[model samples]
Target: MEHSKLSLARRLKLQQLAIFEKVVETGSILAASRALHMTQPAVSKSVHELEAQFGESLFTRGKRGVKLTEFGVLLQRHAQSLLADLRFLADDVNAWSNGVSGQVVVGVLISASARLLPRAVVRMHETAPNVIVTVRVGSNDVLFPELARGVVDVVVGLLPDNQAEGTSGNLTHVPLYDETLCAVVARDHPLAGDPSIDPHQLENMAWIVPTQESAAWRSADAFFEAAGLVAPKRLVESVSILTNLELLLESSMVALMPHAVAEQFVRSGLLSILPLRLASSFGKVGYTLYAERTPTAATQRLLQTLHEVGESVRLELIANSPSTETR
Candidate 1:
C-alpha cells in the first residue's frame, strides 16, 4: 500500500525541526550533539524521528559525517527560514516586554553612506544604545545578492535605473530621492577654474572609474556616449570613496561623485565641480529589503530613522542643486 505524500509542515514539531537544522549545519549527529549539549543517541533519535514523520531518510551517514537527502535539503531550507522567524518572533515579544535592543546588519552603498547613513546610526545609538548596527559598504551587484541570500538584513543604496519602480518577487526597493552626479577635480587642477567644459574636452583625461560591478560606471559610460564623446580609455578602477576623493585631490584624474557628497569638498576648497552637462544622471538613492521575512524591532526603528534622514538629505539636495530639472 502506498502512503500519503509527506507533509513535515503539517505534522513536524518545531523542536525536532530545529534539531535537524543543527545536525545538517554541523555535518554529523555527534558534532551536533556536542553543540546542542545532547548525547549522540538523543541527536540520532531526533533525526530518526524526522525521517519517520516525513516517511524518508533525512540523512545518509558515512564514517566521517552525513549528507542531506533531497528531501532533507528541501526541508532544511524551509526549516531554517521558519526557525529564523521563530527567533525573530521571540526577540520581538521580548523586546516589547523589555527595552528596545537587538542586532541589525545593513549593506550600504558608499555614496549615501557618507551623508544619510551616519544620521540613521546616530539616531539608533541615541535611542537604543543596546542595538548593535553593522554597516557593510558595497555596490548593488555585491549587496543585492546578500539581501537575497538572507545574509544582509537590509540594503541601502542607489537602485539600478533599469529596475522598475516597485516591489517584485521577494525584493522591495524604495526610492528616497534622486542624487545628481557631478564631475569633480582637485582645486588646483587646470579644469577646476574653467567656467564650462564640453563633454568632448574630457574624453582623453584619466578618470577615477568605479568598479565594473558598480552601477555608477554604467552611468558614467552612458553619459559620455550620449554626448558623442568616447568614454575614457585610461582609467583607474577604485571602490573606496575615500580613495576616490584622495585621488581627485592629489591628481589631475577626474571622478564622478554624488552632488551631495561633492558639495562639501567644493565648499572646503578641496575639490571643484566642473560645469559640464551629464546626459545620464545618477539614479534614485534608496533602500531594498526582503519582503517575505519580518523585520525585527530594531530593524524597524532603524528604518524609521533612515526615512527621517533620507527626507532631510533629499531636501538638502534639492535646495543646493543648481539644476531645476531631474533626469
Candidate 2:
C-alpha cells in the first residue's frame, strides 16, 4: 500500500472516512448509527452524501445486509491505510508535544527493505513506542524528488551518483555503509548447481530489468559494458520488487540485486548468488535529506538508530562479501 497517497489531506476528510468505515463494517446505516451513538437518519445522510461526492454507489443493500460494490472494494485498502494514518496523526497531536511522540515518514529503497530499514525501525520503536512510522519505498529516481519537495523527511538508500558530494545540490548526505551489485537466480536454477557461472551466460537468459534510470539498472549496465558484452536483450521491465522476485523464483530470469538485499534471500536458499564480482562501484549508502530544516526529536532518534544499524551492516558486509568496501 502506498501510504503516502493515503494521507487524508490528499483526498477525503478524516470524519468522512470514519463514517464511511462504520457503514462498511456494520453493513447498514442503522447498525452503524447505533454503534456510533448517533441517529440512524444522520448515518444514512452521511453515507448518501459521501456516495454522491464519490459519484458512485458504494454499497448494495438487501435483506441479508449490505455488500460493497466494486469501487468500494477498491477503496477498502486505501481506507484502512488512510484511517490508520489519521489515528496516528490524532495520537501525535495528543502526545507530549515535544515533537518526540509523533508520526514520521521515511522514504526507503528496495536495497534497504530486507535489512537496514526494518532493523532501524525496530530499534526506533523500542525507544519511542508512541511514535508512528510510515515508510515509502522507491528508487532514487522517485524518492529524491519527494525528499526535495519536503514530502519525505529523509531517504534511506544508496545516494545516486549525480547527487554525490562533489556534484552540486542542497541535499545533505550521511554515508552509513557500502554495498555492491550482485546477480541472483532461482534456487533451483540450472546454474545454481555450479558455484561459479560465466557472466556471458546472462546474455542468453531472460532478465528482470529495473527502470533504466534506477541505480541498480545503471550499475548492471556498467558491469555488462565492462565485461565487453551487451546487457541481456530479453528484458522484463517491472518496478515492483516482489514481482521481480516472483519471476526469478518461477522463471529463468536473472536479476541484479544489491549484495545486502540478496544475501538474506541467498542464505535462506530462496535464491542463489552467481559468484560473479564486478569492478563497477556503487556510491555511498545512507540517508539523504533536503538540509534546509532540522528534523523533529522523533525523526532524529530514528536517524540515530539508522546510523547505528548502518555501522553493524557495514561490518557484517565486510566480513561476508570480500569485494565490498566503504567509501
Scanning candidate 2 in windows of ten residues, the lowest lDDT window is 1-10
User: Per-prediction TM-score, please?
Assistant: 0.70, 0.68
> Candidate 2: where is the Cα deviation over 4 Å?
1-100, 162-168, 322-327
TM-score, prediction 2: 0.68
Show the colliding residue pairs in model 1: none
Query: Which numbered prediction scores highest in TM-score against the true structure?
Result: 1
lDDT per model vs. reference: 0.79, 0.75
Candidate 2 Cα deviation (angstroms), residue 71:
26
List pairs with backbone clashes in candidate 2.
none
